[model samples]
Target: MIPLRQLPRLLRIAGVLARHRVDELLPASRRPRSLAWLRALMPAPGADLLVLPRGERLALALTALGPIFVKFGQILSTRRDLLPADVADALTQLQDRVAPFPAAQARAAIERAFGATIEARYASFDDAPLASASIAQVHAATLADGREVVVKVLRPDIHARIDADVALLRALAGVVERTHPSADKIRPQAIVDEIETTLVNELDLQREGANASLLRRNFAGSDDLYVPEVVWSHTSAGVLTLERVRGIPVDDLAALDAAGIDRVALAEKGVRLFYTQVFRDNFFHADAHAGNIWVDATRPADPRFIALDFGIMGSLPERDQYWLAENFLALFNQDYARIAELHVRAGWMPADARLDELEAAVRTVCEPYFTRPLSEISLAEVVVKLFEVARRHDLTLQPQLILLQKTLLNIEGVGRLLHPRIDIWATAKPVLERIWRRRSGPRAVLRTLRRRVPEWLAAAPDMPQLVHGWLSRANAGEMELRVASDDLKEIERRLRHGQRVAIWLSAGVSLAVATACVALLAPAGAPPGARWVAWLLGAAAVGAFALAARRS
Candidate 1:
């Protein structure tokens, strides 16, 4: 439950949602009349807002809420398989079309970011926005060198707004964990922490610029994709400047046709680009919605992709990358058994998970698709189905893979929109095979060894001395050899326990023997009481020895 102080914000959220009639997701007859009084207090929306579809209204409400909600909607929009079709379609607009902060405020943010006048910073700067999104807005500008660039200014008060929304979400996550029956499996807190980290990283424009720079370096000479160059002199923690780029938006089919662009080739390239980035380079653009992607149609015969918004890039650990590549290859080969084995080896499935059972499950899900048209195949859908099957066996899902999943969904979405006939498997196999060769081949081993030679050489001179000392000690009576055996630990524990019991048993026996000797050697004048005491002591010693023996 939220504190009393946060009720107003929560109430405001409810009111805004109610005003937009978002509650109509449930039947109107289901709502209590007590809520009508609160609804009556809200101003009536115009026909324009009311006439729009339910999904649009919901998207608008989230946008109005702020960047945090916008981010949530953006992530939600990617999981079309799990969402209502209309809502998923409408949510794409939230990607980079959220209501932007004012232009004048944007100017002040830019000035404050650079600590200089606009005229002094750029030879020409437009007050009008070229593009606007929840986190930032871009303006056209020209440098002193007559180079065109776009200035990205972070919206003012974004940090505070994000902080507030995150706090509210954290509170909600806490409530969910406490009340929701499936909280442990869902891991709401862990989800929120990931969201928090991503959102916080996005707030720093310098970090985004760095991401863009690294991506640019990765594809410096590549013609398949182009990343805009960052203008370091104009970039800051709150503002980013990159070379102005123009391309046909990926979704604009009419423009693409008009430019004589090859849609089929473009789609194939998109698939290849995704695979190469993920398996080959181990980095990919996680946020790949249409709004941040475009196609360079400068040459109608050839089309290249243009990527923007480097805030969220995905990378996998070397182990995952290798396994994921093999998984893809396995899928391409229709090797269900290989896929099942890989899943088990990767710890995705439980240790005791039956490989044959998993293989049968995968075959049931994928065999029909193999004979179907390539155009109808969705890589994302296949992976999702596999995940569902694995869940039946209690799969341990990795959080790091979520970003890759989202990115894969985005890639498939773009590919489907551009060319429905594009064969993702055909496009990805060669790339995966090449990556596999480079990963485990002899050349890879040589490269690894070359990198490690210096460290090995530094320790090589001590190897002979260490071995000689071991031999010398072994040759002498002082040698103590320790063998590596799994049973040694258990044996050592039992030996120590038996040693303690033996000491007690020996003491008890000795006491009894001494008592017997004293009794036998006593003078004839000894008191009857002393003899009774000796007999009692002997009985006690026998009891102690028996106790020790029983314990041992």
Candidate 2:
């Protein structure tokens, strides 16, 4: 059941959709049948609004709905393969351009966060916002020590707003899961959980500051990329202060050209930087949209990327990191079979899935791209196509990978915008190969053993006792083994049958021995009937042995 407090907000959302005529965008088959009656309650859209393209109207409707929906639209914009081109293009405007809250409210938020007057915190503070996005807005400020910085303040009541909207989204996701035919494949609920986690992390400015600091440290002396330093003294949960830096937005081709920047070098550098972050450093900027990435114009010939907005950062499990690097290498080598094997081994695909079929599917998706010139090929598009094929073969989506996919799309887009003829695979392959060699080399293995051997030695003394305890538990019938594979289950069944046969055979042998002793060692005082009884028992033991042998 819907919460009473959420009904008004739900109605408001529906009314906004109706007011912009966004419902027309959804096909009749895909529309929620239960909410069909809500259309009657909606006010009719203006004729002028109706004349606009459905994609634009939908984007406008999402903007009207609030930051959460706008953010959703921004993510949707990246999946050009999944969405209509026109709609995707329209939704791209939502990235980092949400309407800002009032400056007075922003000031109040800052004051509340610091428990001090705005004048007391900084030497000089700008009331005007430098940039505004869904969760926060930034203002330029000067520190007491004469350093220029940017102060990021969270929006007022953002937590309550996001919580309420997230709850509503979860409810709707449940409805979709129940009603939609492809819900299992699409995984609406999992997507919501991923988005919720990202938003929750983004809400904490201190966490963002930490992420920035770590990234800065990782690339401390690198010429290819620069991360702004976080001002720890001025940062809090609700606000963050960072050393202010200026650069041309990566997407601004005209400005870059005016600054005499080498677009090709810049594009290649971006690709290499992405590989380094993911494969070597294992930490990456998850949100690498054009607005957040900028080009330093100081050295035109050797361009560098300046990263901002560290709210959404991503890393992978060590296993995933290795597998993904290998997967990329396999793709580069056109080793579809290896790719298929890697997917299964990495638990991305079901173990029982046909390797030949998966390999063929992957080839079908990737072969055409190879036929095209490297300049025209899109790494992001290839990954998306592979994902589509994997989905057909029951791919298990990893929630952690969602950010990586989005980041890849954003990075590729930025690269293409900078240099139309950039060869992403060529630029990334060498970087990946170097990292892979370092990680998988003999030195790496020795290093791992060196780190782990001491721990193993410390735990070695308990090995016998632990093994004894486990064996005792098994003998006591207190242990249960669960197997997921059909082959393993079949093997277990056969072993159980063999165990029962062995038990019966042992009983039979014991009975036969006892019967022989009774027959062979009978005293003269014993009745003659004892020998006959022993003979009968021997016959019964022989029968039991025959039954056990036949069953085996």
TM-score of every candidate:
0.78, 0.80
lDDT of 2 by residue, 159-258 (tens): 9888988899888789779978878766778767866777899999999999999999999999999999999989999999999999999988999999
**Pairing residues by index, what is the TM-score of model 1?**
0.78
Q: Residue 483's C-alpha lDDT in candidate 2?
A: 74
Candidate 1 overall lDDT versus native: 0.79
Worst 10 residues of 2 by lDDT: 543-552
Residue clash pairs of candidate 1: none
